[model samples]
Target: MTSLAEATGHALDLLLAGDAGLWQIIAISFKVSGSAILLATPPALLTAFVLAYLRFPGRRLLISLFSTLLSVPAVVVGLTLYLLLSNQGPLGDWRLLFTQSAMVMGQVVLAFPILVAMGHAALQSVDKRAWETARTLGASLLRAFFMVLREARFGLLAALLAAYGRIIAEVGASMMLGGNILDYTRNIPTAIALETSKGEFAQGIALGAILLLLAFTLNGILQHVQGKGVPST
Candidate 1:
């Protein structure tokens, strides 16, 4: 109990002191994950819109594929990317392994399906007449699409928040692709893993606290949005 108390105190000190290492890890985490989700949003949302609005053969199969990918383990993604980026791999010439870019790529893979699946759900839940109403008003195709998006904004925001939560908390892909390089590709999850391995309880606890805070804050806002009458599910 005494040791636990000491560790907690030390962890608080690390946070309160604004320890550079801790902050750097946090910053890199947000940087990579944020960029990844931002890059993925457009295509994912477009794909969702298409899937939700268009009728086509094999569409259900494709939707199922995206849903299945949502549960794929992070290490599996990391391993696949590792091979693709390795020296003998086809894309090896670009030499992107063990870098922040690689980490971001892994996160993109992680977040894409989530955004697509949830976005599709959001768009599909909207009243079909919304699209028709916009088009009947002689709105251009682009404007009609924007109208549908506006109607689904709350649910869309929920989807994005969920995606951000997943990528931010993931450890396997980040550790494998980022290489946990200090002052470089290291991120919150990877840094926490490293610190715990080294028996640095204070640093690990500090990082964990930050993660908990982020998770709580995100979930709080999510609940608030849902309470404010977003789409159910």
Candidate 2:
């Protein structure tokens, strides 16, 4: 067995040498998670907008449902989707199981609630007068909507980054949906899980390092964005 220090050194060497296999796993993670976030974003923003600004029947119920979803475990999500996509399931004809699309679907489900919840909180923080003033100035409904969004931009951006961070690091959904296939759907988290399980600590540690760095970077960016929201004294 390789010593921990030796494995650490080798991991750094693999990273510095730009190992193709490692980068491929990273790329697949970006591709799947990126696609999921993009697909999830528009609807999340619209839903958050409605939840924050519109007074409708059962609105509170909807908000509570989304908040509840935020706490659901990732593996449970993976299991539910697994059954839905399995051959015995209704949607199985689409043959999406163990594919990147399946991974994207799982991630979209995981990300949507976070985006909606956080985006709603952000939009809710804006002064209602911002929306009214835009309309009072003779702006079209769509125009006024955008004006409100601009006022809440920093918060929305933070929500987006936070959602991205969650999906990118999650292993359960990707493992079940993507199958951790080499040179294919294997992503950072799934790859790390596999490597660690197989006693390939060097690769696991290297990938773990990447995720840590990514997390720090996202946190820094979130702080910066929130800072921009504050009035300069």
Candidate 3:
């Protein structure tokens, strides 16, 4: 108990002191995770809209593929991307391996499936009459899309939040692709891993506390959004 109390005290001190390395890790985490979420949003929204509105062959297969990918292990994503970005690989010339970009790419892939699946469901749940009413009123397809999006806004927000949560908390892809480099690719999860391994429990605990707080805050906001009102187009 004494050891645990001492460790907790030390971790709190590190956090309260705002350790420089800790701040760097936090910044890198936000940078890479935020970038991944931003990049994933448009395509995810588009794909969701398409799947919700369009009738075509192979749509089921595509949706199923995304659903399957959602369960794909992060390490697998890292391994696949690593091969693609590594020297002597097809994208080797870019020399993007072990960089922030590499981490972003891996995180993008990791988050894409969840965004697509959830966004699609959200769009699909939008009242079909909304689209019909918009078209009957002579709204352009783009306008109709915006209308539908408004109706599904809450669900869409949920999807985005979920994707952000996944990418921010992921370690496998970040470590494998970012190489967990200090002050660069190192994020909360990866830093926690490295620090724990090195017996730097204070840093690890501090980061863990930060990550938990972030997750709680995000989830609370999402719940508030969902609870406030239903989306109306």
* lDDT of each residue in 149-184, candidate 2, tens digit only: 898999899889989999999999889877889998
Candidate 1: tens digits of C-alpha lDDT, residues 157-226:
9899989999998999988888999989999999888878877789888989988999899889888877
Best by lDDT: 2
Residue 181 local lDDT, model 1:
95
Candidate 2: list runs displaced more than 4 Å.
Answer: none
Identify the candidate with maximal TM-score.
2
- Steric clash pairs (candidate 1): none
Q: Which digits, one per residue and each the tens of the lDDT, describe model 3 over residues 125-196?
A: 888998999999999999988988988888999999989989999999999999999887899999999988
- Pairs that clash in candidate 3: none
Write down the TM-score for model 2: 0.97
Best first by lDDT, ranked: 2, 1, 3
Candidate models: Cα lDDT each: 0.91, 0.92, 0.91
> Positional deviation of 114 in candidate 2, in angstroms?
0.2
